[model samples]
Target chain A: MDDFVYLKNVVTLELNQEKCNGCGMCLKVCPHEVFGLKGGRAHILNRDNCMECGACSLNCPMQAIFVKSGVGCAAGILNGILNNTEPSCGCSGNQSACC
Target chain B: MTTFKNPEKAHSPYILDFVPTPAGEVPRVTGKLKLRDVLGTFMVRWSVNRDNYRVSPGLYAIGDPTDSSDVFVTANYKLSFDHLRKSIDGLNAWILVLDTSGINVWCAAGKGTFGTKELVNRIRMCRLEDVISHRRIIVPQLGAVGISAYQVRDRTTPAATATLTAGSAGSTKPLKLSFNGLKVSGGFNVVFGPVKAEDIKAFIRNNYHATREMRRVTFTFSERARLIPVDFVYGKYKLLIAFALFFVLSGLTRKGVSFQLALEEGPYAVLNILMAYVAGIVITPMALPYLPGRSFAFKGFVSGTVAFVLTLLINFPGLNFPEMFAWFLIMCSISSFTAMNFTGSSTYTSLSGVKKEMKVAIPIQLISTIAGLVFFIIGRLF
Candidate 1:
């Protein structure tokens, strides 16, 4: 079922190859298998499946993953915009850390 | 964290007796919905019933399971478990609940909580090999995001297509999965079957046959409902505070001096905040599909404009030039701000696009709100 792909360039996931120690943590932690290890480095195999959940960034010990987290939920962003605060997941469902 | 008033009472009319498995002892259900179950379902759906909804992670017997029971896997999320149990009212099946940290199957699958590794782990933990005569699992269709059927064989990176038909005799050959895109032809995905208790047998039977048509799979009602809370009841706690702030601040001077009361200039204060809410929270989102904007911030701007006209007609019949100008800035910006917030909530919104829009939109919203607040104070005083 690997041929499946969602919309592209939506997720802000970035991998710093120089900083990556090939720990393979991103591959393991990612639910959608967005990353794959090649030549002892993490490669983004699929970009579209990334839901911007930020599990990889938190799990990445070397800080190799750079994603501006907490911008995924509209309700959170709405609250942030109206209340003048940072936006994140506002709904109780579909969550892990930030919006 | 709201607890169920009665945790032990069975909600499904079926009396659950203890059924022993290698993993642990579990309650065997008769597939009846209990009164408390109905209450719990509503409470949880509305965000009142908190944590107690979760069923323990283990194998559960439905309608008196045997070694031949078809093993259906799901998350420990109460709703997911409940759906499975409630659907099998008169049938015999085994439910294996995974530890998804209290998330439903479809969502947990995307999060990788309901994954192949965990699937293998649960299989081993339950010694499922011994319990079931035939080795097969019916995974939900949406779970393909996290699980590769090829992963079950411990093979290398899967090819896009691989065929292995079971029972090669006649037209009734064993079904095999063929993934072309989002749709799987001759596959083994059981999507809630969009089915209920009465149709359990047919749903199970349908999964066993190979079909070339994409007839079975479509966006189900329950699926869409998961994303949209039609009530707009979210963020109530914050709204209450904002309402109070508007009521109090509108009656006072910028320097905290007051000879004026809220009821006197109530229309000005109440209308401004209300217009903002309608523009952002109500209009932008409710009309999201019809709105003619690609960017959420742009949509918000449109909603804000609509709010301004409505507010003008309702509250300020003879609004002066400055009053019109100030209200435009404040009220429209409020609507615009809320519409932008909807970007984060929308599934279709792209993260990169939103970040870019925020840089420009946020500054404008801030400037407009500040300018509006200042003009409003000036208008009230002078």
Candidate 2:
């Protein structure tokens, strides 16, 4: 967070406060501190900081968080383009890894 | 006590002997980190203690686990176990360490190692029915991807009669369904209650409660720090490995020279490869956030040019302008390749963004490196 400023507003990580129990599952799993607990519920402090890893969404018990997570690496993309495959980084799916 | 990497696999025959805990009773132990554990944690980060980095996967007791002792599940990556154990200061719990190929919960969950299937199977194989009185199995929140709370709840302790209906797969169905047909005769309930440790115990103890049922999870800075090493390895090591390979191959491929003469010229080849390493591996990452430019390719070029200039000024003063320019192009191109690879490790880049960057970046980098290589070879021959 010290020097890293990502491509802004890309992470569609949204949280429904009414459903959020603020169990802090999202807080623990998020690498970028995207969600913070305010009073009794969870709040998205910085939407831009999200890398779309979907870790928060996966960890959220209430199903209150959402993100269009996927592989953001270069070679994976280049390989996908060269091979004409829709390269998935496992961000959108829950079953496999992005690799 | 039991030790099996995969719950689906047979319990290692020696598991009982390996651990002193009684069968069906995982001992409760605080996951306190001693000096050795601290050392292993650091060693695992750098990947030096590869063998020493993992704990045996199976059922473990933190202190002396009883039927009522809490069960905290984690991966066999010893660092994860160590941290979890350490985090529980006064709590007595049975730790069910999963065989995640020595990866932590966050990573293993992504790969499906720390999922519902493993949890349900492990619970049955360990005879958790006899060990814990509670029907609940507390898993890390991050492991939710690999595990469906509904599946785990359905398939937990009593396995022979496990039934997972197709209706349960979709979110539209009832979130929590109780099947009377799958109920046991003794009224013994086996449910996959994947509760957070922090929510269950830590938050209550620390008075981390709101007016209602808000249970807080204590996420320490130290625990969060573990994720950094993987990212560091991903960012730094690729170009370093490439540099080493290039150095060895370039030293061997020199023509009209004895092997010894080629060996004698190894330093030049090393320096040439070193340029790419310095620019891509060292400077670019160290100054990543500050490296001016939206494009990583441009950032790498800038860093590579700096590396080329520094090496040229210090080591190769006799080079002509053409030779210097050729070397610059080569270094910049190689550096660009290395930098572009860092896109995955960066938070800034996305799938669409990287796809766009690569279509333009890769061709330019390839052309510059190739042309520079040709010019440098001609410069050397003339």
Candidate 3:
């Protein structure tokens, strides 16, 4: 996992320090271990490692985390641009198995 | 009345038997995969019969689950269902399969199919309360994107004035119940399981606890390799069109474009495109870790250059310098674009990151391709 790194400083994940109560929910749901508890607040441990999966933000009880999360797939983004819709895995009809 | 579809006939070979429950007859499944199941996985890997690769969605019993047995929820994709069952072998459990339209859990969760609404609806439809005394359901960790744990634990639906249908197959008659003024919860708590099905047993053995390692997703060599077949099959029609277009373009000569010239130069042009395709779709994914650049587009460019150089040195088609350069441009652009698309199949990548990378890469690829075509025609005319 350490060796397989994508782009750096491009993640949109942001956590509000004031709202975080150090519940540790973000740390649990994040697949990339992007958050860490410091003192009594949740902090970004590794921003570059964040894949913006939305699990952390969705699970956070205090609504402290915010990220424009979606599938990081180039094909999905391209499909969205071409079709004039939100980014999707292009699993509409007939063509399947994008992810 | 809709005809009652037999579960055995609908989901043949997978259903071992049906166990009668208070709700209805729940199809019984086995953890041990049969020969056909193995073959089915192999066929899916190669994109054969892939669209129809799904199991019927409903409640299933494994190892004679009782009222106190843990109810594990999973996607309707046969692979997801199979993995869940196989991982919990020798354990008595109930499986609640959601209709993810044959997609795996994580992907379906991302798309909102393996979602909170679906989970709640399935639970009510299956009459899980009658079958199990416990008020807990275990979901995969990846499915957390679509399922809010607090919501599942607290959100209550108005269970009034709505007809509750039990089975999709019409085997069970529609039951009407009036629990007036009672706001009904999903009737269960959601506990997210480990990210991988292989860890389900360990998590269960440890009293339903998942370690940090189990929660993290990794893209190992085998994982990346498994995705190659599907990625390779993507946009194949576009590849064929590129071949057809290039095959005709190669026919351009000093006199005029003709089939004779195409016959002479077409093989070389087609071969170059094929090599580029292989480098991008196959070699790029397999050799991902070893590749030099962070950007998939850059990594693909490097691979394409190596391939182009090898072909030029060993199997030169005796073309002019301009024609060769044109092929180089074409190969790299094709490889770069295709490899960039691999970000979708990859385990870790952010939407912002891909969007940024594509903003730069797509324009360069387009310009290079157009320039290559111009150079190729100019060389042919001269």
Candidate 4:
């Protein structure tokens, strides 16, 4: 029987294989098991599981990765849209009033 | 459809028919509740027990509210509901909740879920005109994005005042006109204040894996190596090429430059590489605040020069003209490259600023490195 995988299809992660230098750093750091090594190169086996954390891009030695990194919370996105700024979840700030 | 037994029936007796006095309001004991309890209720409202969403988005009365008690506005998200109830010190206040799809005021406002149409619809649904005689409603500042004050006034006769909106309307506006006046509005305000710093710190701590885990540190017999190549990968490769060129030039000047000679000369080669790396990676980030100049490139130059001087004092012992010139070139190159990395980290620097810095800095660094290589060849030959 094939192993079952729980996928969260909220975000997508893409890898430019031609730019990958086969540094297994992405595999070592991703909290989600999204990438698999195929023929000595890193292949993104599970794109939907990615949270768009930008970990792969930051760690890629060859500068071959990119992602739209942002919080998934609607509150933060609303603030960003209203203020014409990058959206951020208010969870990081003063907690006196925010739930 | 079955008549949804109004949850309001439980608190019906306490519901006040008029606006409460703002002063001498008894502080409610809602603040002492545990965060988990509040979050659990919110999760339930958002997920499994969905009636919290169906609670006829309108005004509510949480506790026994008197005519002279305070009135607060909020969303129906149980977490939001709990936050408002808990914040009051001892105030018997009317609670007006708008339907926001389980989202908070700031976000709901931004998405237009908490705008004039919803507020009007909710007020009408709850028969707010019969429950309270007051024409005022308080809103949070964060929700300003979603609501247009002008539009709300046009749609509903009730006056809407934001907690933080700049107004000289005196106290006569039907709404007491402060974000803090309403429990839900105040929640939005508090989240954007001092609590923001703690949130940022937590975010940084949690995301360290994203920031630092990409790079690895390797240790060699003579030196430590950082395996995580910096953003500008080409710079490191170029430094290696420059060193190779220096060695080739050294060989051309002499009959044969053996591996032993290269090893004996390893310190200089390493020093050049170390300077570039330090300026690019370590010094650029760590010394960002103390760098003498504002321009990131200039700061890198200063750091590179310092590193160069320190290396000369340790390695050359007695600095001659050739060594001093070569050292100068090496420092300049290392600093320029490191300074270029600033564009990646800063919030203020623009893309054009980075382009300009690179256009000027890269050529200077390259020319200096080449000049230093020429000097090294001349010194070895003569």
Best by TM-score: 3
- Tens-digit per-residue lDDT, A19-73, candidate 3: 9999887887888888899998999988999888898888888999999989898
Model 1 interface DockQ? 0.11
Model 3: per-residue Cα lDDT over B254-277, one tens digit each: 777799989988888888898998
TM-score: which is higher, 1 or 4? 1
- Estimate, for each residue in B1-382, the C-alpha lDDT of model 4 and write its tens digit: 1012574533332232323233222222233456565556544433334323333344544456654333555665555555665654245555667777666554455456666577667656655545444445544433333444434554554334333343464444333333334322211111111111112223224542222222211122121112123223424565677677555543433666766666566557566657766775567646655666545667778878888777776777544577567767876676666555543323223233344455566677788878986776666655
**Which 10 successive residues of model 3 chain B have the least lDDT summed?**
B1-10
What TM-score does candidate 3 reach?
Answer: 0.91
lDDT of 1 by residue, B1-382 (tens): 1112345633434446767655456567656777777787777655564444676576667877776667777787777777777776677888777777676664565557777677666766666655655455665544443454535434221233233344553444334443332322332222222212234455566774322222122223343344334224444555577667666656765567453666566556676777776677667766765666666677878888888887788777655666678788877787787677655545434455666577778899899988987777676555
Clashing pairs in 1: A73-B344, A73-B345, A74-B344, A74-B345, A78-B341, A89-A99, B11-B34, B12-B32, B12-B34, B166-B174
Work out the TM-score per prediction: 0.65, 0.66, 0.91, 0.35
How high is the lDDT of residue B70 in model 1? 79
User: Each prediction's Cα lDDT score?
Assistant: 0.60, 0.59, 0.83, 0.50
Model 2 misplaced regions, further than 4 Å: A1-3, A9-46, A56-68, A75-99, B4-23, B27-53, B134-138, B144-266, B294-298, B343-353
Better of 2 and 4 by DockQ: 2
Docking quality category of candidate 2 according to DockQ thresholds: acceptable
Question: Fnat of each prediction?
Answer: 0.17, 0.32, 0.69, 0.00
TM-score of each model's chain B = 0.72, 0.67, 0.89, 0.40
Write the candidate numbers in order of decreasing lDDT.
3, 1, 2, 4
User: Once superposed on the true structure, which residue ranges of model 3 sit more than 4 Å away at CA?
Assistant: B1-11, B156-187
